[model samples]
Target: MIDPFGGIKGKELTNTSGFFVDKEEAIKEVNVSIGILENKNIKKPTFLETLRSKKSKNTEIHNNVWDYVPNTNNEYVNIHIFWSKKVVRSKNGVPIRALKVALVGLKAFYRQINTLKPDLQHPDILECYKLSLENYQNLPPIESFISSEKQDLLLDPFAGVTGVDIYKKYNDLKKDKDLTLEEVKYSINFIDQLELPKSKRDKKFITKKPKFVTFTFPTSESYLNVHLWWAGQIIQTRKNIEIGRTRLALASISKFIENIDVETPDLEIEEIKEMYEITKVKHEPGKLKTSRIELKPISKGGLSYWSTKTHRWITGKYDAKNKIFNPPKQNL
Candidate 1:
């Protein structure tokens, strides 16, 4: 359990320091400190008993002022205390008790971090300085770095162009000494509309569809004729084949259809073979003549090889030893 503001009783604190005139002033000061904490994303204590009652012995956060665990770091506390105290000092009717209460809040704020890494000097007693308000004011708006129109085309609805992408443009615009923030904001709005599409599926945003009908016949005269003849036979016989001429022929035809765009391009080899009930050995070889083909094994010192001596794969005895599979080349 931690007490952000340690046991600084109002009566004891007033007896030692001239900061607060009375307990009322101390309450006012604590309230203002609570507001500052809330603005910095710290949650204020919500329970009614926290303001009037002491913390339970079993509780972790000893005070009832903060609802959630404070995530603030040292820099924020230093900046907050410096700015708040300066403002507090410039006003009249603020009791010395107010300052004492602020110190209590500061002590609690310091404890938020100090407990994690113990420090000898307390943040409240340390020589604190004021922060620059003008630095934050001069910083550019977040929307200035983000592109609105570019987000429309991206699949992610929240995607935006980074501010760094617009640094040169922003700097160039700033060169005009008379350029006003209002005008800059307007120009940024114009940039947001650039190249943005009205609709997701608009023709203006879509790419041109490709034409699929045009294709030149295969280069090899023998291969082209074989493919055409095989396709004709499959259309006629409609037989399925697992190996040899029928299977090879159908695979070649399917590939050709895929290469050139056609109206009925999806005719798969299996579908065509099923239509004719084509068996692997059922097909007669066409007029095309082919010499015996041999394949070298992929691995060095391996005995496995493939031969196309009879227009079908004739695997060597070493085929059992070779685990790699090499499909037969379609040279037809």
Candidate 2:
């Protein structure tokens, strides 16, 4: 049998595993396919060509691509190709080969009658749209551009950050004063509005929900230990430290998996606040909203109070000798 892709006998690139599509051949095939489609009886959509050169002249199908044709009533099928490539050593430790390309994704577009002009006409929406269009207009032309790194950054869902918590930190370090949070919000909204469909068979294309964990407060030594474990994981995630609802949950879960001993009694507010200060992470709304933890109890118990001055928890204490609080409890 003859090999379609020529074999390599030299050293391979690092960090690449498996095979990658031959970039030169892939580009040639793409161009040929476009020519064939354009010459069809009914001109095929040029959208595929748009995807080909969007990132670079030699497209490697790093992510995914889809060909959409609306109002076809299933007569026309949308094409989707998710081709991933990696560099890998051969059995002889020579060179890499392209992984078998799989065509798993399919999509079909349908047009819908609109009664939503009113919502789009909002002044704020219009203004954001205007600003976004202006930004795109000001960008350098493709021929004059140095690299596609900036374009790739804009296309990232979380801007390459692990999550919202990390994204916030990443944004703060940006020196570009024109890149406001509002503009970022508007840009995301714009992308979401261009909602694309996916093939049922393409399991990899699906967006899974972010994982979450629960933790009750005034917790046991084990529970406190879990929180501390989470703290450590969050610390190791990056050089900068920032806490958020989701980040804290992930940390606790990591600690639980290791079965680490819980040395702390409880994860008091003061301890968390002190951590924020040490890490220089700003404590704002939703910054440390730990989930699965009760803030106040309905039954008999002293109220949990937070001290603004000390930034610590002042737990409700019972006076066993007096059989009551020193000042006595107030009746509702």
| Tens digit of per-residue lDDT, candidate 2, span 1-332 | 76666664665642111111222222333344334334433232357665765434343322222232234332332222211221110011111110111111011000110112211222222222233334345422222311212122222111122211211222211211113222323323322222333342234323421112222333321221112312222222221222222233332333222221111223355543344343222312122345112223222232543333333333334567987643223331
lDDT of 1 by residue, 1-332 (tens): 67777955554432212222222233444555555544443343547646656344233322222222123222112112232233211111222224334446444443342211222122121111111112223323322322222323212100111111111232211222112223323222232332344453345223432111111233321111122322213233323222122223333333333232111223356553332222122322221244112232323232323222222222333144675444434331
Q: Judged by lDDT against the true structure, how good is candidate 1?
A: 0.28
Model 2 whole-model lDDT (C-alpha atoms): 0.26
Among residues 3 or more apart in sequence or in different chains, the pairs in candidate 2 whose N, CA or C atoms overlap within 3 Å are 16-87, 230-251
- Candidate 2 regions with alpha-carbon error over 4 angstroms: 1-13, 17-29, 40-79, 84-152, 156-332
Per-prediction TM-score, please? Answer: 0.14, 0.18
How many clashing pairs does model 2 include?
Answer: 2
- Residue 302, model 1, lDDT: 28
Instruction: Quote model 2's TM-score.
Output: 0.18
